[model samples]
Target: RGFFTSNRDGGQGYDDIYKFLETKRLLCEQELYGEITDLETSALLPDAKVSLFDSRFNLVSVTNSDEKGNYSFNVECGKTYNVRAEKIEYTTKEQKVTVDDKRGKTHLPIALEKSTCKVAIGDDLGKCFGIKMIYFDLDKYDIRREAAFDLEKILDVLSQNPTMKLDIRSHTDSRQTFKYNEILSEKRAKSTINWLIKNGVDPSRLTGRGYGETQLVNQCADGVKCSEEEHQLNRRSEFIITGL
Candidate 1:
């Protein structure tokens, strides 16, 4: 018999408990059991929500961790599950777990780490230390919405360090003419640099360069058919901390 248990309170919460059990009964019809734990300093986090999603990243079920930071849910076997944890003042963590027919239960432990660096800004910003590789879509100079979040992080770092200089370099997949890609990549790099300048980052501290298809991170050579993801890797914008 499968059941739900928590150490927070006794029988007073039976109403919610019964409802949860009924949902679990329905879930058990097509799902296996999953146990999750937070391994951060052994501190219990009550009411932390745990959601399980399938291979396509669609939510399958949801549960909450007890005061002891423990959560369990019934999930389908032979499916990939993406587990996500959320809490205030702590960065969200995600992990992909696969369940197989041979296993009746899955135990997963997650650790949440803290961010230590101060935000960068203004004249002191030129001293920012971290350089991140930003990715882009095929032949597109415009930054993707997903890339904006990362750029914001970089902006925060720059805001904290006022005297830093960053060189923005753009690259493209080896599918186009060298001259064409070189010109397009340079334009892309400049576009990104312009975006930073417009967003409060100092213009003098930034430079842009286009490397075209000259820098290949993978083996897919020019004129060869490759996966979109592979080609996407070639189309990237990266930052280098050249001066501080």
Candidate 2:
């Protein structure tokens, strides 16, 4: 067996080691090879990250797709692995693989779909796709199921780009006192950050803020008569990418 180190700058400025071994053929061992491609057009995605995890969720190995979007891994007989492919602005693709008790190489192809949320740097709070103004119940700071579902997309973007940082901001309508709204919106923002942290996002990459009816989308301000729909628009949450 021999170890080869390459200065493959997979965007992280780090070295990666590749192992090579020469051995006799065994009936119970095999290797897995595959490529990552776009699910819609079937075009290859370069620099996509491929990760192999064991049954207990321990990370076994990680590699970046080459220019051709190709990746590979070696395995033993009957061992199970969860293979996940991730890329920025794309929905993660996952598959379960188990090597059969036969010799030879196995092929496992992965396809990732473009994410509905096209999150980009310098994008305004609600400008991105799949990101809408999150509304909350009256005076409530807890996260709703619908809000949680939408937040997952933002989480995916943050997870794939580890160096990215965001500020989770919350707002409220003029129905409540200014001070009260401010405090409530702050809690709401904290709640959003907490949910993301609980779902495996790093806390260092996130911050919470409450604008408290300060940045109204329209003229629905205090002493102004507005429809319920207009008021709902003011009570919202947003995610802003603060750093790269």
Candidate 3:
């Protein structure tokens, strides 16, 4: 549908809005909007940080939910975006949305589950986000970027509790000799402790050691053939609050 002005050379010499039907391209401004709420109660959540990321996980834009739990964004049509909503002590929720070519606004409501990180003395920050293992490349003990993010949860807890003491234990699968595994475990454990000390935690409150391959969460130890995932169950870092 399209329109043309008649005031230029017609009998009705006045500006007027006209309506017509035709096949033509028209520009459209696309928008995305929705509400953030609690998953358990369906209650509206306010002040939640809402972020949009592209397919590569690169951040595109960020916004916050208002007091009414409403958030919106100007978006492009025919593109997929990952919308994530997060708040402190709440489990972050992410959903992938593909905005179709159809015009107007798209509604994407998300609900966040409550986090299990209780900040108690026996809590394992590593397991708080449902990610139990902090993986290390074989023979590498340095903290990776993904590992750093996981460690931040522990750092946050320790920072809030000055008297908390952590026992950092690093373990490795039984792919190598016992002595070698023990040494590697110790190195990895110490590396974990060093990360905490380097960040802000006190040296006196942290103690670490490697358990070698002594503790296997599954039957993937020694020479038993197992999938890579089963082997990964044995390679993990355990951060426990031993004292508070």
lDDT of 3 by residue, 1-244 (tens): 7676666555465876677985676665568899999999999999998988776666789999999999999888878888878777676667899887877889999998887656566777556555346777677788876576556556655665678898988999899899999999999999988998999888999998999999988898787999887887777789877887
Each candidate structure's TM-score, on Cα atoms with residue i matched to residue i, is 0.51, 0.54, 0.64
- Arranged by TM-score with the best first, the candidates are 3, 2, 1
Q: Cα lDDT for residue 180, model 2?
A: 94
Which digits, one per residue and each the tens of the lDDT, describe model 2 over residues 1-244? 8898888767344777778987976447778889999999999999998888775556778899999999988777778887878888777667888877777778899998887754566665346544556778878899876566457556766666688888888999888899999999999999988999999998998887998989888899999999988888888888887877
Model 2 spans > 4 angstroms off: 1-122
Task: For model 1, give the 10-residue run with minimal summed lDDT.
Answer: 120-129
lDDT of 1 by residue, 78-119 (tens): 677777665544445667888765536777766654434343
Judged by lDDT relative to the true structure, which candidate is superior, 1 or 3? 3
Better of 1 and 3 by TM-score: 3
- How large is the C-alpha RMSD of every model relative to the true structure? 11.2, 15.6, 6.8
Candidate-wise lDDT, in order: 0.68, 0.80, 0.80
